[model samples]
Target: MATTMDHYDGFRTFSWFADFVGLPIDQVNFVLTQFTALILAGLFRSSLSPIAATPAARHVYGLIIGLALGYFCFGRQAIHLASLPALCYVAMRTQNPRNMQRVVLAIALIYLSCIHFQRQIYDYGSYTLDITGPLMVITQKVTSLAYSIHDGLTRREEELTPMQRHQAVQKIPTTLEYFSYIFHFQALMAGPIIFYRDYMDFIYGHHLPGSKSLTIFYDKNSQEKEIVLEPSPTLVVVKKVVASLACAIVFITFISDFPIQRVKEDEFLKNTSMLYKMWYLMLTTMLSRFKYYHAWLFADAICNNSGLGFSGYDERGKPKWDLTSNVDVYKFETSLNLRDSIESWNKGTNLWLRSIMYERAGRNKVLFTYALSAFWHGFYPGYYLTFASGAFFTVAARSVRRHIRPLFLESQRKKTFYDILTFITTRIVMAYMTFSFILLEFMPSIKVYLYLYMFPHLLGLIAIILPPRLGLSKKAHKQSAEIDLSETISNGNAHKTM
Candidate 1:
């Protein structure tokens, strides 16, 4: 007989209404978690805002809520919660920056590997129910904290880059503070990976002084400049929450009917025409994106409700709300190229990879970063296949854009036509490339690609090889080799801004 862990459906709940209504157990649990966090955040903002303004109070409150939720969700297994603080303590103890980074990353990778491996062997099909997901979020936090500490303590101020200086951890936080940041309930689940400096700024209510109009005001009388607190924009939070919940409802209603596994069936491959197959793939990919859209938008709302995601003001002086936004729905949908599409989707994770991995990886940064991404996701062979294919896709797309894009730019009408063609091509290529990511198994993904005649893969190879021969210099292509990972971190500026 299969073990309970092997066949778990993720519907653990005590409410009779849930059973009576016959709701999906997984979705019910997800909604319960999101709503619970939202309510707690509102209470904290309204009733305890003054007390919670203090870092210590905020830390204690976060710890209590996080512990309670962990126990409620995972029971005795909540004991694993100790691992995060333990790792953070060890990182703090290692005073050497390089050593600290190495130790933290090693421990996090090992822990995540173990969890992912165990789940693969035992809990293969249960999506959104596994404890490993939360652990993965924790992995990002701990590793980032270690690197931030290294930037602050190990490297000289002059030696650091602008992004590095912005994220540098000036002081070693106490165990309590560290735990609070790691277990912050708002982003404890599907996260936007808040940086150490950003979290500290939120805790201390210190908005950085910049050229922007929305500067944080300070009291003049006090020698130590005290930050004036702004009221949490409840209206903005409400709008985002409502929108995200709607997206979630749509996904929950349709995702079951358009199951990704349907592509693997003989009827789907054999009976469908090429155009129909492509259209089906696009629809499946679009539906798949809604799941992420819901999670990310809901997470942003939770953070904003507690006044955590406020960055500054736009040119018109309207307050910007997206400090932890993960996806740009408009850019993701209308992207004319792979770079724009990838950058717009999972904005937070890409930022993490850029700041931590891509910048550090030297000559072969593109390949290195892609490999790290594959590793970070988990042990799925399909993940490796997708990333490997993506590497070629990037090379081909860059070649095409560089050599072909300039030819159409002479006329606005030509450029418009070019953009339209590229947009459609990008969507189809993306759907084909990411099909494996949803499938998660090697043979299924391979079979589906074979059925599609491996058109995109072959096209990508030809595109890369053909570009230079057509008089696009090797020098021109050399500049495109580096992944353009840098993006402004402010709201509504450009790519990668949350």
Candidate 2:
């Protein structure tokens, strides 16, 4: 029944449905919606006064991710169980111990609804899991594995039987699409991966407000970096927002062009114009910029929004921004000798990085973080190439920069023609990497082109975009903080509003 024209028909149908439902057909709408929602969702988690730490926030943050997974896997015919994450995140954020039972029940009810609804409209294909699918997979896999090990020690008469304590392994889906919920493209579609373990601690772990740990291999000493909130409310709360927005937005247009990402098998045979090359870069980076800026924008927005009324310090007597994105949530926010683009952009994700890989990896934190980050981007091929190429080269660039730091720091090297070439090269590389990511994200076709030719030309470009330490703004810094929900919630029924 399929034909050459089926693709066009399918695409047209999807567009009509999206437009009818007021969903964005382009990547820009996609970026803004998820990024803005996630920031708000993170705040809900921070306000939970979590009795225990959990990735409950991702419940809310995962809403968008769930939506995409549902639509893609189940098609637009029905809503999927992914929306439960948002609701769960919101419910968990409520500090009332009495609400626990209600939260559980609500979660169950919502999940059941999605499961039944999905079942009726969409068959449970191998890949098409409902709410309990992932949990069941993990549960069965672990139980069966444990049972196998237990049965080995002794005979059933003398030792534990698999049924008594062990269980059978659950069936796995053959198609990836059925379990697409796990590989959320919307919630974390553009951002970094946040593990469940780390997410939980933020909600319930009751350590010091800013006591989470962060270690980076990039630092020779492997010192733990603690984020201190600067006392200048106006600066952290207000001024930097505009900068983050500007820095994020200008490049967004360049990233939104997702079509540019498809790796072309052979170079376009007709390509001869400089204008073609120019459009290629512009469209690709636009997509990445949209996502990058959206994350920065929302984080900044939440912090400022929460910092609106109560002017108070943390238990440690440090100034406060919004605890939602505050650095106090992590162990440290240390400095590295050389700054790279991916690291820089992700660091802008607030405390998510610090509490995860940065703290766990110790000295090799940057490298570890970068590698995982690249992988976390998606189940895609080009992202790994971009991430690995960028990470290694950036590390090398940092090492080389250290040698020349004295030159820039001491003002020994003036901006000569050669220096300008280096500057242009670095910036162009930055632009190129950013462009490649966006293109792959939107277009998918450009990845081959990127890997074959553009990626190779980026060596000189790296030098251009990297900001010398001298150029880094020596502004007042703030220490990150953990918050009590009573304090962070909007007096306007903070928890209740959601």
Candidate 3:
């Protein structure tokens, strides 16, 4: 047994079962931890429903589960968990929103700095994968909290964007509550990045009540406000978990067959036809999405199981189960435009970027937001490469949609053909653009792009230059820009779904 386990050493230190199974430890631990969270969520929901649903009780329950899981997965490294909440508490104690925001961001950056420093010193070539994953989620939560506090306390309500207004943190939570929110077991590792207000509302059962005033499209025949009781989310949770399990199985079973790194291989580049190469890239990108699909769906199911993802009814009076969904898998797979593709993938992160960065940037919001997103992701050069490429892609895609899409939309057949063309184009462009993000290194990413002929980059340049000459005047450009920005930022209805 010891000899067998030694062969599986990578999967041994974390758990006895992992050692017994002789599989990679981190993978086993990750899957097991997610499963544990699901079980705990169900237990907590059933045990605490209507009886111990106070904020304090919820906080205590969350803290216990989060800390236990942290220790089980990370052991002594779990000590680092205290640092974020400690700094956040200090920020709250300052009682000044500006100072609080500054302090919280500073502390979060310092924590990230320490993580990078440790990676450089000890694990230089390991790529800093799962070990620091939770820290990214923590960074988003802390920064969002700080910003929300500022919005509520310092900024005038009239000046705030609709999202900022809805997510404003009116009071400083108790230390226990703050820590619980930060370390919520469901979202601590993989997240949908719930806002502080949304989490608090769920805790107090206030989410369902405040929906009447919010925008809700009713069916044309329905006039009466039917008092629909909030349905139990057990069914929703089960469905999502099953879907996530399927994604996980697909990733495990097929990812090796469609290796992303094969694109960089000399034989593949030299021998593969352009048509086959495009197909390969699409398949590789689709496979890459499976890992994220599993994580986000699992997190969504956990939140729903705990009754934290309730967002009230839809147009047809059906309950919405996507309040905490990070990805709309169908929309992501079939996205007809760059904006929709980007927004559909990692939606929670997009919501955070739009709310915290895009809406606040004074000039060049798109550039600033993408830059901030890259920086927030990490120090990887490939991240910058992807973001830079993404900026061009967004411009080209938007220009095409604005100037060309209307021409085809006059008839259903034309629109269908256009949608199909755009869908394929979007996938290919995105796959080409984001290959670097998966690779996470500068030279390798550039090498792959070069092998692919860099047609997308060249096309984007042409779009940028030709748009203005094709009746796209400066005034029209500005108006188009505002329309795009409004579509992303100023749309209050978008916030509700997220």
User: What is the alpha-carbon lDDT for the whole of candidate 2?
Assistant: 0.38
User: Whose TM-score is higher: candidate 1's or candidate 2's?
Assistant: 1
The stretch of ten residues in a row with the least summed lDDT in candidate 2 is 475-484
TM-score of each: 0.89, 0.42, 0.88
* Residue 153 miss distance in model 2 (angstroms): 28
Question: After best superposition, candidate 1 residue 139: deviation in angstroms?
Answer: 0.7
lDDT by residue for model 2 (1-498), tens? 112222111123344544555433333333344445445543543453332233343333344454553344333332333344434434434524333324533464445445544443444211122233332222222222222222333224344322322221122222222223233332233323322322223323321244333432434677654432313345464544565566555654444344443334235424434345545554455444544454544444443432221235678876555433322211111222224233334432323333333443557666675664553333344456566556655655643453343243334355253356455445545555555444344344354444335553454345444544335333211110112233234321111100
Measured over all alpha carbons after superposition, the RMSD of each candidate to the real structure, in angstroms, is: 4.1, 17.0, 6.1
Ranking by TM-score: 1, 3, 2
After superposing candidate 2 on the true structure, give the runs of residues whose Cα lies further than 4 Å from its correct spot.
1-270, 273-279, 299-340, 348-370, 408-423, 441-498
Q: How many Å off is the CA of 477 in candidate 2?
A: 29
Ranking by lDDT: 3, 1, 2
lDDT of 3 by residue, 1-498 (tens): 323322221224555665677545666777778899999988777886533466688888888898877767665566667776677678777757766876787788678767756654565434222436777777778888888988888888999877899999877878887888888898877887888888877776666753444334456787643332456788899899999999988987898899877877889988988788888878888888899999999999998888778788888877787888999899888878887777688888888888777878788777888887787776777778989998878878767866666556558999899999998899899888777777677887777777778888888888777865787555555655656567656644342111
| Clash statistics: count for each candidate | 0, 80, 1
Q: Deviation in angstroms for 289 in model 3?
A: 0.7
Q: Which candidate leads the pack in TM-score?
A: 1
Candidate that beats the other on TM-score, 1 or 3, i.e. the better one: 1
CA deviation > 4 Å runs, candidate 3: 1-16, 19-22, 124-129, 210-229, 472-498
**10 residues in a row with least lDDT, candidate 1:** 489-498
